[model samples]
Target chain A: GGIITQTPKFLIGQEGQKLTLKCQQNFNHDTMYWYRQDSGKGLRLIYYSITENDLQKGDLSEGYDASREKKSSFSLTVTSAQKNEMAVFLCASSIRLGGHAETLYFGSGTRLTVL
Target chain B: GDSVTQKEGLVTLTEGLPVMLNCTYQTIYSNAFLFWYVHYLNESPRLLLKSSTDNKRTEHQGFHATLHKSSSSFHLQKSSAQLSDSALYYCALSHTGYQNFYFGKGTSLTVIP
Candidate 1:
């Protein structure tokens, strides 16, 4: 079994500031994803990478850019933080696309607070 | 677009009692999948159950969920609720060819002693 690790569990930022969140998975899964969870709201997918250099956008991909620098690491950059934009960013990895091979495993979320 | 809805935002139950969390979904595609993910405080979200089989019961770790394709629902239930079962539960859905998954508003379940 492998684990997904996210850095800077807590983040504080100012309006218009650009911030980045990092995630690493030792599972060697081929797919990586970034999602944002707002209080009392369901998680929304921001971006996903099927392979090391592949990038795909989700419904909430705007204002965010993602890069899969390596097979184990995926990074998300908030182009500009908005005031009152407080939410938890979660990272997940999955083996493949649909069914038994398509289960996703999430990492401990990174809570971000913009002042 | 695929969407998920979990009606109750919070569910309070007594330990050793039965518990149920409702989950419903809508999708345009015929071949779709439903999933239940559990999130505990200070911990990451984990898969509790998943199923694509219509009208079939899927069980895991004492928790069970059945997909009712006719009803477009995949409600989760457990025979006995434990204090350790307190957590946030999310219902998710995805189409056969969709790259992104859609999740419902989370339901927070709290079990009291």
Candidate 2:
């Protein structure tokens, strides 16, 4: 079994600061995704990439940018941190089967706290 | 637009009791895939159950869910609750050839001994 690794288990940033989160997967999956987890809000998709160098926005992509640098890595950047904004960012990868995505394998997540 | 709904924000039950989590969805596509994911503290959220065929029941890890197209629901259930069952549960939906997924607000279940 492969694993998805996310760097920086915790992050603390100041208002208006830019922060980036990185993810790497060994599953060799074709698609990668970034999701934001908030209390009582579940997980909201921020961005997803079907292939390397491809990016697609999701329902909650206003303040985030994503990059799929390679087949095994996906990254997300917070344009400007908001004060007291605290959330967990998750990275996931999945393979496409029969024209649709299969089960997603996720990272442990990066907890972000904006001060 | 596709969307998923999980009504209960929190559920507290005694061990050995039954487990039931409600999940409903709305989508324009007739062929939809419904999924149940469990998220334990400090761990990644993982797929607990998934179903695409209408009226079919899927089971995994002692958890089961049936996809009822007529009712637009896929509810997760178990015969007995355990302490390890306590976690956050999310219901998700996706359509054919769609890479984007819609997830519910989530329900947190706590099984007390």
Candidate 3:
């Protein structure tokens, strides 16, 4: 009965500005992830953390950075927003149970638009 | 590198018809897991079905999918499509003992009344 909360559900940013999206999960899960969703492209992993203070670069992490300072929170920052960039960023977390396949619980998402 | 592929970008169907979304994957690991996730508008994307055992059909909320290791496919299907079933679907792959997962481009299903 836990929830994932993402702040600033809709975001508008200026080109070249740094934008940060925040996610907090009360699931107490050990693994957290950030994903970007485009119109046609499925969700692409931006970054992931196995535990607090850990970070793993995903396939599309070139222009993004993530922080996992606490187990309950994970934040993603766009290094420099691009003009006309628009995408929905999702945050998810999972519980690691030995060798079992973990199910991901996701936050609603942060929709970003850069002018 | 591990990856998932969902060929159909969008599917339109009348209610009461059958529904099928094709999913295929490529990975070096043998014990990889395949999943079907549904995303309804204004809701968080959630897991619909998952399978790791080859040829074992996994069903949830009237949807079913079987992971066929031989074919490298895990397609989602439903016998009766409903208007409320309209949503975006995604196929994902994850390796055993690891949390890193890869997702395919989503398939948007529109079931009209």
Candidate 4:
């Protein structure tokens, strides 16, 4: 059994400040993703990486940046934290299913509170 | 645009009652994939069920759902509700050959003991 760990379960950031969230997976999955969850809103994908050094933008990637520095880790950075922004950031990883598609295993999530 | 819709934002039911949460979707691709994810409070959402073939029932962990391509719906159902079954359920969709996922505004189920 493997686990997906996310750093800083609770984050309090200042407005306009840059915040970074980290995720590490022990499953050795090839695909990683970052998603945001706001109250009463569905999970929105911010970024997804198919392999190392590859990034795909999702609908909610405008104010975020992602990096896949290694196979076991993926990171998301909020370029400019917006005021009153409170959302849970989730990290997920999965094996590359290509045409078959695979299930995503998610981390516990990092809840962000921008003051 | 591709999207998923899960109505019934808050469903309150007594334990041991029949469970059903409505989920509908819209996509341009014919062969799209539909999925249900269960998220407990303050926890990451876990994939509960997934299916691509229409009219086929997919069951897992006492939960069952079927992807009806003709109706573009994948409604989640359970025979009996348990107090532990209370959680937020999300409906998601993806195209056949693409990896992008679009999720619906989740449904929260609260089973009272």
Candidate 5:
């Protein structure tokens, strides 16, 4: 079984400061995604990468940037942290089989606290 | 565009009772796939069940869900609720030939002993 690892499980940043979160997956999946989880709200896609150099924006892509530097690693950056931006960020990876959507494997998530 | 809605934000039940979580969705694609994911405390969210065929029931780990295209709903159900079943449940949707997936707000279930 493969695992997705997220670094710095907890993060504390000052308002207007820039923060970055990193993710790595050993599943060798072709697709990687970044999602934001808020209290009382489900996970919302921030960005996804279909391949090592490909990037796609989701509905909540604003104020965030993502990069897939390698097939196993994906990184997300918060341009400017806000007070209300305190939430957990999750990373996931999936493998498409026969051109069909497959199940997603997610990391434990990084909890961000902006003060 | 596709979106999922989970009506109940929190569900409290006693152990050994029945469990039911409502999930509805709206999408323009005909070949839409519905999914149920579970998130345990301090654990990463994972797929619990999924179905693409309409009217066909799907089950996993004592949980079941059937996609009803006519009603645009895929509600998760379990005959007996257990303390171990207490967790956050999320409903998701995705269409064939697309990589994007949409998720609902999620329902938090707490089964008291």
Candidate 6:
């Protein structure tokens, strides 16, 4: 069994400040994803990478940027923090089998609070 | 476009009672996968069950769900509710070979003793 680790369990940033969240996985999966979790909104995909150096935007990718520099790591950056905003960012990795993705394994998540 | 819908935002039930969480979906593709994920406090969300075959039921951790393609529904159910079952539940949908997966708004269930 492998694990997905996300750095910085909690983050506090000032309005308009730029913040980055990091994720690392030991599963050797081919795909990684970044999702934003909001109460009552569930998990909304921000970005996903099918392979190293590949990036795909999702429905809620307007203010976020993602990078997959290595097969085991994926990072997400918030361009500008919104005032009084609070949300949890999750990192996940999955392996594709038979032309479809299998179950996703997620990290504990990074809680962000913008002041 | 693919989408999932979980109607109840919150459900409170007494312990030992039956548990039912509604999930519905929409996708243009005929072959779609539906999943139920449970998120406990301070823990990452994990898959509870998933199904792709129509009219077939999948079970895990005492929870079960049946995928009904005719109705576009995959509802989670359990015979008895426990306090440990209290958590946020999400319904998700994915099509064959599609990298993008759609998730519902989620439902929070609280089983009180």
lDDT of 4 by residue, B1-113 (tens): 88788878899999999999999998888888888999998677899999988789999999999998888889999999999999999998877567667889999899999
What DockQ class does candidate 6 belong to?
medium
TM-score per prediction, in order, is 0.93, 0.98, 0.97, 0.94, 0.96, 0.98
Candidate 2 per-residue C-alpha lDDT over A1-115 given as tens digits, one digit per residue, 9 for 90 to 100: 9999999999999999999999999999999999999989999989999999999998889988888989999999999999999999999998998888888899999999999
In model 4, what lDDT does residue A114 have?
97
lDDT of 6 by residue, B26-79 (tens): 988999989898999999999899889999889999999999999999999999
Interface RMSD of every candidate? 2.7, 0.8, 1.5, 1.9, 1.1, 0.9
Question: Which residue pairs clash within candidate 3?
Answer: none
Predicted complexes: DockQ each:
0.58, 0.82, 0.73, 0.63, 0.78, 0.80
In model 3, the Cα lDDT at residue B76 comes to 97
Query: How does chain B of model 1 score on TM-score?
Result: 0.97
Backbone clashes in candidate 5 total 0
Q: Supply candidate 5's per-residue lDDT for A28.
A: 94
Question: Relative to the unseen true structure, what is the C-alpha lDDT of residue B57 in candidate 3, on a scale of 0 to 100?
Answer: 96
How big is the positional error of residue B86 in model 6, measured in Å on the Cα after superposition? 0.3
lDDT of 3 by residue, A2-113 (tens): 9999998999999999999999999999999999999799999999999999999998999999999999999999999999999999999999876644999999999999
lDDT of each: 0.91, 0.94, 0.94, 0.90, 0.93, 0.94
How much is the TM-score of the A chain of model 3? 0.97
Q: State the weakest 10-residue window (summed lDDT) of model 4 chain B.
A: B93-102
Candidate number achieving the greatest TM-score relative to the actual structure = 6
Q: What share of the true interface contacts does each candidate keep?
A: 0.59, 0.71, 0.75, 0.57, 0.76, 0.69
- For model 1, what is the alpha-carbon lDDT of residue A42? 83
Residue A24's lDDT within candidate 2 is 98
Off by over 4 Å in 5: none
- Model 4: residue B48 alpha-carbon error in angstroms: 1.1
Per-residue CA lDDT of model 1 for A40-105, tens digit only, reads 878988999988999999889999999998999999999999999989999999887543237888
Question: Which candidate model has the greater DockQ, 2 or 5?
Answer: 2
Residue B42 local lDDT, model 1: 93
Per-residue lDDT tens digits for candidate 5, residues B36-57, read: 9999999999999999999999
Ranking by DockQ: 2, 6, 5, 3, 4, 1
